[model samples]
Target chain A: MDETIEGSFQIIGGNFANAGEASMQLKSKLVELGIDEAIIRRAAIATFEAEMNVIIYAAAGRLQYYITPHEVTIKIDDMGPGIENIELAMQEGYSTAPDWVREMGWGAGMGLPNMKKNSDEFKIDSVVGEGTTVKMIIHFS
Target chain B: MKLSSIVESISLEVKTGKNNLQNDVTGVYISDLLSDVMANSKEGNIWITLQTHLNIVAVAGLKNLSGIIIVGNRQIQQDVLQKAESEKITVMSTPLPAFEVAGKLYQLLNG
Candidate 1:
């Protein structure tokens, strides 16, 4: 718990088959580190939501995590069309995902809110034509 | 109650993770939305949904759900069943809709 642990995972967009792999890996890593079960669950949920966002919207992305004694930090950086309206995107049940994605039981517009709810601290940055970056921190106490 | 007991009582079809039928059912969560399940489902809860996609397996695994009940006898893909097996998450199908399945499960668990 004293030393810092870090890791990174690649996320391929539109790969529904492999979606949430990064989050799953992160969850396993946290479990291996012997973190608290509740903390691990929150971290896992936040990271999974971020991973899904990249898969559903971006072309590709990287999920990186840093685990310290006090907190677990997750960052997702992707290459895809960014959100035009952060406010609207942050609202619950507001999604721009196409019908195909909706048909697959996703795109309910709860991803961002879920991430924020699970994380002790959350931040999102995006450019209209470029991409989006999401950062979340879960405190371990 | 154990998952195998519920399956037997309800006549649900076992698709995969047959060996995992011994898992103890903590509760039931009915949702087709992946994020909703991710956000709300507790560990050991059984998820009931109409989704047959591979990501359902991922959600079940992430939440550490006891199992998945695919209601309405939805046609689950072969790959989905395989993934569920690998994840060690029991997935069953039933001809009944979500409402009926939920009702039966509620009685068994709370009755």
Candidate 2:
């Protein structure tokens, strides 16, 4: 592997009906590119978590995948009411998602932790009223 | 039993994929939560869900699931059905609720 590729996905906020479209497409593309299964699963899980966060909390966002011979990087940028407490949000089973989202079986607050666990590197930036952006990287061998 | 047999045995009314039964379902998993299913489901299981959303199909695709069966008499969205068809993943709907659908699938798979 001595090459690289990049893909970008636009995540629409409040689009419960159409979410995950981009992530799925990216997974297919990676499969076509012969990306490793572990790396592809990590990328898929990260994208899924990010997409859900954008849909559940943010107004809108964009996701980008940077693939290289050594590793893959994912970035999610969103515009919405940002996290007031980043540390708390990172804790598992802690969620601020409303009743409806919970009723449908999300908001377990596993999104961030799962993203971090599945990725080789993880970083999150947020402000009270600004927004949230998650950057994650997973190395390939 | 074939996937078509599971459908016939359970009396699952497929809103789509009537001809795509050539796809085999080795197992089945039932869940309404998109996130949980994506995380836990083994590949090639027919995912049964009542919460019909476009993400259901995506999760199935990610997990390489045989197909998704929407239960509880819900109407499969046009866009979702189209996506499923395009992806060659079988999509179907059942009037049965989640638990009932699960039981039926179990009986069919065992039968």
Candidate 3:
């Protein structure tokens, strides 16, 4: 395990077409770093869910990662209409994505649950009408 | 079944990479959305969709997908084709809809 590996991506809002870029980059990088596939998939799921939130919900956001021998941490911060109910939002099958988003076969509301399910540690903070911030960590241990 | 068989069944045109259709495939998935594909696709699965985008190749790379079959006779963006070529991702297209391709693949593979 490399003691130091880091990556950062600036995910844009409303660019639903390119929403998965960051996670894709992260996945390739992890493979190059020789990280475990399961670990890579876990981090990818969390980061992708958070990134998509920024694209569909937030106006824009940044996905930043901090890597170490022990863990891979991903943080997504977005500026959008904040969630009114984090608890309900965390539940599966809840989404507010636009018609086109759904037409593309997404917005099924499985994003949050899948993110949480894949990560070792997950945190969410949001203020209605303000914005949202998400943090996820997956330890190699 | 080999991609050659799928092509014959669906009347698909091997727009590029004819050598690619020679690859063996075990299953098929039809989806336009990228994330859903990322989560569900297994290696050696041929994906059929109407989505023609650059990122689709990236998703195929991550999932280790066998190839992509674009529906609706959609014109694949040039940039997307270039990336697919570099990645060695097989590309095929059919005028059929996503549902028909899915059904055909299911029939061939499941039978």
Candidate 3 residues B1-75, lDDT tens each? 887888888788776557677788878877878878888888888998776656778888898787899887666
Instruction: Estimate, for each residue in B1-111, the C-alpha lDDT of model 1 and write its tens digit.
Output: 888999999999988889988989899999987878989999999999987667889999889999999887566667778888888889999989999999998898998
Model 2 root mean square deviation, Cα atoms? 14.6
Of candidate 2 chain A, the 10-residue stretch with the lowest lDDT total is A91-100
Q: Which ten residues in a row have the lowest lDDT in candidate 3 chain A?
A: A91-100
Residue A57 CA error for candidate 2 (Å)?
0.6
- Real contacts recovered, all predictions: 0.11, 0.11, 0.11
lDDT comparison, 1 vs 3, better candidate: 1
Clashing pairs in 2: none
Candidate 1: DockQ?
0.07
Residue A70 CA error for candidate 3 (Å)? 1.0
- Stretch of 10 with least lDDT, candidate 1 chain A: A91-100
- Each prediction's RMSD over C-alphas, in Å, is 13.9, 14.6, 14.5
Worst 10 residues of 3 chain B by lDDT: B72-81
Q: How many backbone clashes are present in model 1? A: 0
Off by over 4 Å in 2: A1-3, B1-111
Cα deviation in Å at residue A58, candidate 2? 0.9
Pick by DockQ: 1 or 2, better one = 1
